[model samples]
Target: MHILFLHSNYPAQFGEIAANLVAQHGDRCTFVNERVSGDQQGVKCVTYRPASGATKQTHFCAATFENQIWRSHAAAESVAQLFRSNGALAHDRPDLIVAHSGFVSALFLKEVLPEVPVVGYFEYFYHRYNSDFDFRSDLPPQSELSAMRLQARNAMLLLDLHHCEAGYCPTDFQREQIPAEYQPKLQTIFDGINTDFWKRDASLSESHATQRMVAGVTIQPYEKVVTYVSRGFESMRGSDQFLKVADQVCKKRSDVRVIVVGEDRIAYGGDARFTDGKTFRQWVIDNNDLDLSRIHFVGRVSREELIRVFSVSDAHLYWTVPFVLSWSMLNAMSCSCPVIASNTAPVQEMVRNGQNGLLVDFFDIERWVECVLQTLESPPETQRMGSNARQTIEQNYCLTSCLDKMRSLYQNVRMR
Candidate 1:
C-alpha cells in the first residue's frame, strides 16, 4: 500500500503512523508539509510554500481564511507536479491521503486525485463563547470583531470536514466541539504515547540525591522536586497560576524545588496583549512574589533528559483551560509521575482524582499548593498514584494500540 500524509509540519500526528506502516506492514509512505526538518528514513519528504498570503489591507476576520486558501492552492500544485514527474502513471498515485485539517492542506487535492480517499485530522474547532477564548475571567471581555474572527477561523475547517471521506479528533473533548451535523463522520483517537521509551527508571530515584541532575539542573539531597512541562509559558496552560502555586508551596515548605520546562513565549491565547511590553514569563515574575532561586527554568531538553526529570519528580503539575490537551502531560503520566492537573473537561477525561492522579480547580491556587504538599508528604500514596498513572496510559493511550486503530481506519476508508 502507498500512503500520502499531509500536515503543515512534518512528522507531527502522522509521524509514528507513517513509520509503523513502513517498518511493520511494508507500505510505501510519502509526507508533504510546509517545512521538512526531521529524520525521514524509509519515507519520502516534500515541501511546499504559499505563493502569497493575506496583505495588511485584508479584513481582520478573513485574514486566516485567506492564508489557508493560498496554502491549499500551493499544496495541490505540489502534488500535481509530483504526478507529472512520475509520468502521470496510475500506480504512482497514493492509495490514501491523511491530512491535518487545521491548515486545509488537502482542501484542493480532490481536483488532482479525485478517487483517492482522504482522512482529515481535525485538532480543534474554535468558538467565540464557551471555549478557550472566554474560559479565563482575568482576560478582558471578547470584542465583537474578535468573535467574528473566531467564527471565520472555522471556514476552511468546515470545508475540509465535508470534503474528506472520514476524519478524526485526538480526544472526545475536541471532537464534541465540532458542529453537530459533522460529528457522526469523526472518530476520537489519541496520538498515542510511547510507553516503552517514557517509562520511569527506578534507579534514578534510588541514586544518591547529591548526584541527581537532569538537563543541567541539580537536585539537593534534602529537597523535594516538582516538575511542570509545556511548549510555552502562557496563560492558556496556566503558567501564571502554576508559578503562583509554586511560590506558596516553596514558602510553606523550605525543602521544595520547582523545575519548569518550556520556552518563554505565548504558544496560544492573546496573552501578549496583557503583558505590557514584556514576555508573559517576565510579566508573571514582575507581578508575583516568587522565590527565584528555588525555581529552575530549564527552557527545553531532549526526550531522554525529560524522562530523567520525571523519574525524580515527586509531583508533576499540569494545568489548562478547556482546550487541546498537551502531550507533555501524557508523557509524564507514561513515566509513572504523580500528576496534579486542572479539573477541566480535557484533563478530567484522563485523570481520575485520587485514583490515577489528583485534580484541582484551575483558579484554586491554595488547593494547588495543598496538592503539591500532599504529594510530597505522603510518599506511599504518591507512589501508588504514579503506578496507576502508568497503567492508565498502557491500557488506553499506548502507542501500539493507537497504531493498530489507525491502520484499521486507513483500510476501512480505502475500501469505501
Candidate 2:
C-alpha cells in the first residue's frame, strides 16, 4: 500500500507511528509537510515553504483584516501547488492520506486533490461562549463569538472533510466536540508514547545526556522536584489552579520545588502582550505571592531535560479539564514519576485513583494539594504506584501498540 502522510508540521502526532509504518513497509510511505523540524529515516519528505504574510498593524484594525485574509488564501494556494508538482506516485496512488491539519493546510490539500481521501486529526473545536471566553484569559476578548470561531475554526485545519475522506482525534472528548454530523466522520485513536525511551529506567546520570537541557532547565537527580509540563501556564492548562494548590502545598513542604516545562508566551503568540502582559505563569506567581526560590518557572524546557526531571522528581503534577492527556503526563508516568491529575474524563482514563496514580477533582483545590503531598510523603507507595504506571504504559499505551492500532485503522479505512 502506498501511504501519503500529511501534517502541517511533519511527525507531530505521527512520530512513533510514522517510524513503525516505514520500518514495516519500507518505500510504501511518503510524507509531505511545510514544517519538517528534523528528518525521518524511511519516509520520503518534500519540503515546502510555509506561506504566511501580514502587514504590521499596531492593533488588529480593519487595515490588517484584508492582509490576513489575503495571506490565509495565498497560503492555501501555495500548498495546493506544491502537492501537484513535487509528490510523484505510481498506479498505487495513496491507499491512505493522513494529515494532522488544523491551520488551513488541509483545506489547501482538498483544493488540489479533491478525489484523494484526506484524514485529519481534530485537535480542538472551540465553543467560544461562556467559559470558553474566560477559558482563554490570555487572549484578548473576541468581538463576536460566532464570527471569531468561524475564523478560528478555519485555523483548526479540519475543514478538509468537505472534500477529503475522514478525520481522527486523539481523544473521544475531542471528537465529540465536532458537530454531531461531523462526528460520524471522526475516529478516535490515541497517539501513544514510546515506553522504552520514557521508562523509569532512564539513567539518572547526566553523562548519558547529549548536553541538552529542557527549555534550559538542568536536571540534577537528587533534588526533591515536583514538575508541571505544559505549553504554558494558561487557563485551559489549569495554570491558575496549579498555582493555588502549589502555594498551599509549599506551605508545608519547603524542600520540594516546582518546575514547569514549555513556553511562557513568546512561543505561543511570539509576544507576551497577547497573553495579558505577564503571561499566566507571571500573573500567577505575582498575584499568589509565590516564592520564586521554591517555584522555578522554567519556560519551554527540552524533552531531554524533562525526562531528567521526571527521572529524579518526587512526583509528576498535571491537571486539565476535559481535554486529552498531555504527552508530558504519559512521559512522566512512564518514567515512574507518580502522577497526580484532575479527575476529568481524559485523566480518569489514565489515572485509576490510588492505583497507578492519584486523581483529584478539577475544581477542588484542596484535594489537589493533598494528593501531591500524600504521594511524596509515602515513599514506598509512591514508588509502587509509579511502577504500576510504567507497567500500564508498557502494556497498553506504548508506541508499538499504538502503531498496530493505527495500521489496522488505515487498512479498515481504505477497505471501506
Candidate 3:
C-alpha cells in the first residue's frame, strides 16, 4: 500500500505509524509539511511554504482563518507537484492520504487527488466556554474579541471535517468537543504508547539503597523523587499549580526531591500575555516563595533518560486544564510509575481514582500535596497502583493494538 501523510510539521502524530507500515507491512509512505527536517527510513519527505500570510491590517478574529487558508493553498500546490511528470505519480499515485486537521493542510487536497480517500486526524475543537479558553479563572477575564476569535478558529476545521471521508480523535474527550452534527464522522484512536520500552525497571525500586544518576542529576538512597513532565511551563498544563504543590510537599517532607522536565517557554498561548515581560517560569518563581534547591528543573531530556526518571519516581505529578491529554502522563504510567494527576475530564478517562492512580482537584494545592505524600509514605499501595497503571496502557493503548486499529480504519475507508 502507498500512503501520503500531511502535516505542518514532519513526522508528528503519523511518524510512528508511518514507520511501522514501512517496516512491517512493506508500505510506501510520503510526507508533506511546511518545514521538513529529519529522516525516517523508507519514507519520503516533501516541503511546502505559503506565499503570504495574514497582514497587520487583517481583523484579529479572521487572522487565524486567513493564515490557515494560505497554508491549505500552499499544501495543495505541493501535492499537485507530486502528481506531475517528474514526480512520484509518474508511475503510481497514493492509495490513501492521512492528514492532521489542526492546520487544515488537507483542505484543498481533493482538488489535487479527488479520487483518493482522505482521513483526518482531528486533535481538538475550540470552545469559547467550558474548555481551555475559559477554564482558567485565575487569568484575566476574556474579552468579546477572544470569544469571536475562538469561533472563527474553527472555520477551516469545519471545512476539512466535511471534506474528509473519515476522521479520528486521540480520545473520546477530544472527539466530544467537536460539533454534535459531525460527531458520527469521527472515531477515537490513540497514537499508542510503546509499552515494551516504557515498562518498569525493577532495580530502581525505592527499597533499594544504591545511589543512582539520571539526566545528570544524582539521586540519593534516602531521597524520594517526584516527576513532572510537560512540553512547556504554561498555565494550560498547570505548571504554576505543580510548583505550589511541590513547594509545600518539599517543606513538609525533607526527603522529597522534585524533578521537572521540559523547557521554560509557553507551548500554548494566553499565559504569556499576563506575565509582564517575563517568561511564565520566571514570573511564577518571582511571585511565589518556592524552594529552588529542592526542585530540579532538568530541561528536556531524551526518551532513555526520561524512562530512568520515571522508574525512580516515587510519584509522577500530572496536572492540566480540561484540554487535550498530554502523552507524558501515559508514558509515565506505561513505565509503571505511580501517578497523581488532575481530576479533569481527559485524565479521568484514563485513570481510575484510587485504583490505577490517585486524582485530585486541579485547584486544590493541599489535595495535590496530600496525594503526593500518600504515594511517598505508602510504598505497597503505590506499587499496586503503578502495576495497574501499566496494565491500563497495555490493554487499551499499546502500540500494536493502536496500529491494528489504524490499519483497519484505512482499509474500511478505502472500501468506501
TM-scores across all candidates?
0.97, 0.81, 0.96
In terms of lDDT, which candidate is stronger, 1 or 2? 1
lDDT per residue (tens digit) for residues 1-416 in model 1: 89999888877888777887899899999888889834587888888889999999999998998889888898899889988684778998999999998774697999989999999999999987778999988866667788889999999899889989998999999999999999999999899998989989888877745667876888887779999999999998999999999988888989888899999989988888778888899999998777878889999888898999998899999999999999999999999999999999799999999999999999999899889998999989999999999999999999899888888888899998
Q: lDDT (0-100) at residue 125 of candidate 2? A: 68
Superposed on all Cα atoms, the candidates' RMSDs to the truth, in angstroms, are 1.3, 4.8, 1.6
Which residue window of length 10 is worst by lDDT in model 3? Answer: 82-91
Query: How high a TM-score does candidate 2 get?
Result: 0.81
Number of colliding residue pairs in model 2: 8
How well is each residue in 1-416 modelled by candidate 2, as lDDT tens digits?
66777654666776557777878756367666566633577776655553544447423333333433443355545545544555655354566677765543455555565566666777766554433334344445545533454445443443455545677787777777777877887777789888778765344522333442433455443345677888766666677788787777777887666776777653322224344567666766666666565667777666666777787667887877565567888889889888888777677777898899988877788888888888878989988998899888888788888777777778777787
lDDT of 3 by residue, 228-323 (tens): 999999988999999999999999999988899999999986776778888899999999998878899999999888988898898999988989
Candidate 2: 10-residue stretch with minimal lDDT: 266-275
Q: Which lDDT value does model 2 have at 277?
A: 66
Go through the candidates in order and give each one's C-alpha lDDT.
0.90, 0.66, 0.88
Can you give the lDDT of residue 256 in candidate 3? 84
Give the lDDT of residue 158 in candidate 1: 92
Clashing pairs in 2: 102-156, 102-157, 214-301, 214-302, 215-300, 215-301, 215-302, 262-300
Which parts of model 1 are misplaced by more than 4 Å? 37-39
As for candidate 3, its clashing pairs are none
Per-residue lDDT, model 2, residue 259, is: 76
